[model samples]
Target: MLNVNFYEHIDDTLLKFAVIVSKSNGKWVFCKHRERTTYECPGGHRELEEDIITTAKRELYEETGATTYTLEEVCVYSVSDGINESFGMLFYADITEFGQLPESEIERIELFDQLPDKLTYQDIHPILINKINSFLKVKGILNNIELKDNIIPDISDLIDLYNDVGWSNYTKNIDMLKLAYDNSLRIVSLWDVNKLIGIIRVVGDGYSIIYIQDLIILTEYQKQGLGSMLMNYVLNAYKDVYQKVLLTENQTSTVKFYESCGFVSNDKYNCVAFVQFKM
Candidate 1:
């Protein structure tokens, strides 16, 4: 059985190739080699220390003769065939034209409405297809969630979103809220067009320790995975930090959500958080 492991960031030196899976007009485009009857996604080994992204485009063109297209990154993945782990970046493309078929090792190209029975990498094709579909669905939704980093938002809009999410205790002191944002190590705000819908703020030295100071999504936007999107954005940005921390009210739903994002209770490390209330 082949095992795959995913990470937020890996040493690029360990990367092997860029695998591009393309679709055109709702049909999948696959490559056929002169020596094989089985079809495969258009991909090739990295050459002469080229960037993985460049390798993706070059391989797609060389194998499928694709000229006009739009490509989007899907993810970075590593597959272990029970011995060695091979790392590669996965990409999605929408090919519009073949232009002219180039002379290469590829024999021909084919389009299919459904996956063909003969695939070069049988165990991997289904996994890549599922990932592509999931990526398309999530990208469709997140396309509207615009994220801005290190930006000073309009205070009025900030207050309004804070109030809309019932964080009125903080919004009540607008200056304090503004000051907190100003002092944050990093801030990522999510907007729907001109409307502010979500905000995530971080504090502490960005290298050694980072704390999620605040993460709020307007009540109307809650439960739509926007929160997860914001959290993921933050995690990806600060993935190298040694200590990532957050404190939230101990609600079952809240705990479950954070746990799903790889967060664990401090109790698991024999630690506890304490706060003092002034009377």
Candidate 2:
């Protein structure tokens, strides 16, 4: 089985290619190669000294004849099977116009709301499309995401969100958690229609510092940039504060995720953080 991993960032030294998952109106866009009957997203390998964004744009135009569109970065992704690891950037595009298809390896372009069965990389295409949709929802690319400040969500949803992420300790102390939420300096909750999907709460003076206490998305809703979205909302809301901080378990992936949001390791800045535990 191919191993696929998603990242917030990675160096060029490990990247192998880029993929652009595009949509026009509200339908998905895919390309067919001249020698292949199966469909695939518009993508290709990087050229010498070419930036990855340019690679995605070039491949999208060459494959689908996209003439007018806006693109957004989704995330970095990697795949491997114990032999060699391959890295790529994931991108999403909203195409508004198309020109005549170029005379290239592409045979044709197709748009769909429901994907066709015959895809070039059958094992990978579907997963990539899902990731793209998640990107859309999280980044508000094709969906309306409502943000509520100081709005309290349903207790059940909050419990589910915390429990889904293995933070049952918070769930077990739901009363205390609710009290804390009620007193937070600010609360940012993200919603899809009426569903409580993501949330971030900040505490501290509105001017001096803002400490993020809880930032969560339901387990089934992770990896689509929802976490980053929540972080961005709080960071921007308190951009002028001298101290913006959070403390979480020291795991590699978790640390990387936070770092992507303009945060640095305390050690990197020659500062130290101390935490005390009560037994």
Candidate 3:
């Protein structure tokens, strides 16, 4: 994504940014700081090994400690920080609930639904405001996103899904072993009225980090964007809520697929053994 022509006007450009936008207290909420103004979203630096949304979540909590909120991905834009820092991705999030701003946020924080009158122009950049506004207008997704409480069914058709779909290749194996052992594994199943369509198994300490052991989807259920959903459900159910979701797979397609679901490579980390041989 680098072009000499683009950097000609800026020097030593480094850093990408994302913003979290929310509506709480019956009003629109934007974070204000020495960082940026013009009613910007809440987000900060991209860390060494962190994914974008994770960075956003960490930043929001560190700055505000307001854990109760719904997050949505709006868009990403690149820009210069006006210093040596440049080329940032700004993401928008909507916070439906508001909590008291921590003391650390007082001097650096200002929240507003509408543009402040005669607001100090220093922290907020004009171009950044323009970018946020443009995105908000086009996407126009306010009030459409509602809180969802996932409803889980008792008898899922997920088993039949594998038998009918190609992903059944692995899921069928899983079904055969279902009654054999519990083995401290948490097998979350998703199904419809007729059959089992998707499945994933997670095993770990059940506290710090959980490893995704198996993920199977009926081939017929593929390409409908369910893989990401299943991964995300597992992640939130374990990783985000618990701080770590780790899985190892040899397939390039699997890696790419999970990456899109917010998995990143840890060079310091590698598979000890996808399979352990009987000694």
Candidate 4:
């Protein structure tokens, strides 16, 4: 029997290969070798003195003719066949353009919405695909849910979302709420079909600092991991900013949630936070 295991990180030396699960214009990219009839994701063994990432890029370009693309490390994976084991780094790529196929073992490339039944490595490909799907879902890129940037939702939908979460201050003044959204540096809203389900609003100079003005999720979706998804989206968008800040109620659950998202308390920095509100 064959077994596969995944890890967030491992010794770089252990990664002897690199496999890229790629997509172009929302279609899966798979390649067929000149010597085989089955298809597989583009990948190959790491070469002498070549980093795993370099191997992935070389293989992708050679096999699929992917000239323009974005690649991200997904995780490390190992395959064991009772007596021997091998390790590889998994990557996800979004290809934008393709040039002429490089002269290589790959005979042709195909795009599909789903994987073909005849795959080159049946024991390994399915497990790797599942890992990629999970990674995309966590990064808020997959699933039926849609995330919109700076899109102000309908007033009724906004009100319903805030009211469901017991946050009446925003719902009480629809005009002010809309103005707040309009003036913010960025607003990321999450939707389930047409229903507005969650939002993360930011106020900042867009360079040195960004404050999380508000993050709200409809009550029904509270424990569904959508909040972290929204938080991760904003955090990644502002990763280059020097400072990321937020203020929240002094509650245990809320503190824990933010902590899990990589936020540190002011007290840890030996600093205090103050806010003034007009009565």
lDDT of each: 0.84, 0.85, 0.52, 0.87
Model 4 per-residue lDDT tens digits across residues 49-105:
999999999999999999999999887788899898788999999999999999999
Q: What is the TM-score (0 to 1) of candidate 1? A: 0.61
**Clashes, model 2:** 0
- Show pairs that collide, candidate 1: none
Give one digit per residue, the lDDT tens place, for model 3 in 177-222: 4542255346665554334556666667778667776666666445
In candidate 4, which residue pairs clash? Answer: none
The sequence of per-residue lDDT tens digits that candidate 2 reaches over residues 98-180 is 99999999999999988888998877778888887766565653276677888888788899788888887788888988898
Candidate closest to the true structure, highest TM-score: 2
Sorted on TM-score, highest at the top, how do the candidates line up?
2, 1, 4, 3
For the record, the alpha-carbon RMSD of candidate 3 to the native fold, in angstroms, is 12.4
TM-score of each: 0.61, 0.77, 0.37, 0.52
In model 3, which regions exceed 4 Å deviation? 1-159, 163-176, 179-181, 240-249, 266-274, 277-279
For candidate 1, give the lDDT: 0.84
